[model samples]
Target: MEPKAHHVVIGFFTLVAVAAALVFALWLEKSQTDTEWAYYRINFDHPVGGLAEGNAVLYSGVNVGTVEDLTLAPENPAHVRVLVRVDQNIPIRANTKAGLVLANITGSMSVQFTGGSPDSPVLNGSRENPPVIEAQPSTLTSLLSNSETLLTKADQLLGSANELLSEDNLENIARILENTRAASESLLQSREDLIALLEQFNAAGARTEDAASRVSGAANHAREVLGKLEPVIAGLADSVNSLQPTLERLDRLTADNEKALDTGLQGVGELGPALRELRNTLRTLNSFTRRLEQDTRGTLLGEETMKEYRE
Candidate 1:
């Protein structure tokens, strides 16, 4: 009977120890730290991965707080409300961003605070509102949603490309490549011709330089000749100046001769009429002389002289 009693006592103490341990754990979970802390709420439109009460809240990767509660937001049923207890001396500014971050690959998540502007006013429960940030989709979710369509399109494209690379088509492509190679060779040959042309241009430039030098020398010779001729030209100019008065006198003499020629022409015109009158007078005299001669001849001969006197 005493053994049964001892066994009962042992069982009772064991149960009491377990109960005390559970109570101590509950107290540890519910108790606040000695440091003063304040509560702020962050709202998100989706589940914040595995974030729950007692999850660590970090500011710039340093743990500064803990999540106090998580519940669906009353005002926006689609969103969730997360209550965080942060240290009162943390100096959280209004511009601080709270983001849900995956803590590890096991799908656990936490709320992280970063990039608080120092000039911004400190946030309080009454004045603070949750900032809506851009949401990022998980890699697994994105891949699951679009992988089939992407793979299907990729497969079709690959099949089409394979069909395009068939042997006859490949031969045609080879021919095209060969033609391109020939064109490239032709271009290279043309480049050689271009180099020769540049060489010719250089030679022509040398010739032009030589011609320019010859032209410059000829111009200098012409200048020297012109310099030598300058005095001769001046002397010729002086001679022309000296002959000017003589030329003027000759001009006056020529005018006087022209006037004399005009008077001579008039005299000749008058003499022509006088000569014509003299010719008529001569003709008449000649006729008279011939008659006188004939009469004399008849008288001198003594024939018909008595008849002539009776007449």
Candidate 2:
């Protein structure tokens, strides 16, 4: 009897559980029916990121629908046909696009709906076609692949770098550093020569400055000399002017002296004959005087020696 009671209890509980499950299933169905829904289709030439049914359909990050079906397009085997059931009031327009999105790094993907033109009419049925967007390669996938390749290449490069930094290379580097040091020392030794050359240039510049100063001084001196000589030249001109009349008078005197000398010469020429006659008269007078002297001497008695001397 207890076993039968236990069986009965188990059967009652099983019936209640089945009834509850049916009620829950009916509630789910009614809830699904209550939602206003619409169907649309998109066609693609390739698998859209491995999109499957029940994938979320998002419009600007808002989940508005889900993918209902995926099949090969009837006309084109290469093309895939996707059916989407969205909320009825969502108002997908004719120009809307259905693109696949990678939702995660683990290759999970979703459908993104966008580009509904306001002027275009709203899509009604499955016949209303939304344009399928070609899926671009995901950045995450590309970055992951690139990271792997980069890490592999980095390892190879690191190995090569390690080989390059071997002991022989280190010694070569050391030798190069030593040579550089020697060259630097040689350059340092030449610094004094460079400084000396600069000093010489400075001295030359000073000398040039001195020469320029001397030239300026000479110019100033020349200007001063010319300034002093200007008045002297003016005085000389005045003196020359003052002496001009005297010079003219001297010239006139010289001319007059020349004329007087000429006139005197002419007078002397005119007196030549008169002077000759006078000279002859003087000679006769001298003879008369001599005779008178002789007479006187005779008269004075003792002039016979004077007469013989006269002959």
Tell me each candidate's RMSD, in Å, in order.
Answer: 17.0, 18.7
Local distance difference test scores for all models: 0.79, 0.80
What TM-scores do the predictions have? 0.40, 0.40
Off by over 4 Å in 1: 1-32, 50-53, 74-78, 105-107, 117-119, 126-176, 187-194, 201-311
lDDT of 1 by residue, 1-311 (tens): 99999999999999999999999987866765466786787767655657888888888888888888787877878778778878777867777777777678876777888777878988755214433333334444355447789999999999999999999999999999999999999989799888999999999999999999999999999999999999999999999999999999999998879978899999988998899999999999898678668787665565664454553
Angstrom error of the Cα, residue 127, model 1: value is: 15
Model 1 residue 52 lDDT score: 84
User: Model 2: per-residue lDDT, tens digit, 1-311?
Assistant: 98999999999999999999999999988977898888877676555655788888888778888888888877888777778888888978777776677776766667777778889987687435643434334454355547878899999999999999999999999999999999999989999998999999999999999999999999999999999999999999999999999999999998879978898899988998999999999999898778777687664565555434554
lDDT score for residue 126 of model 2: 49
Per-residue error (Å), model 1, residue 288:
49
lDDT minimum window of 10 residues, candidate 1? 126-135
Q: Report the Cα lDDT for candidate 1.
A: 0.79
Which residue pairs in model 2 clash with each other? none
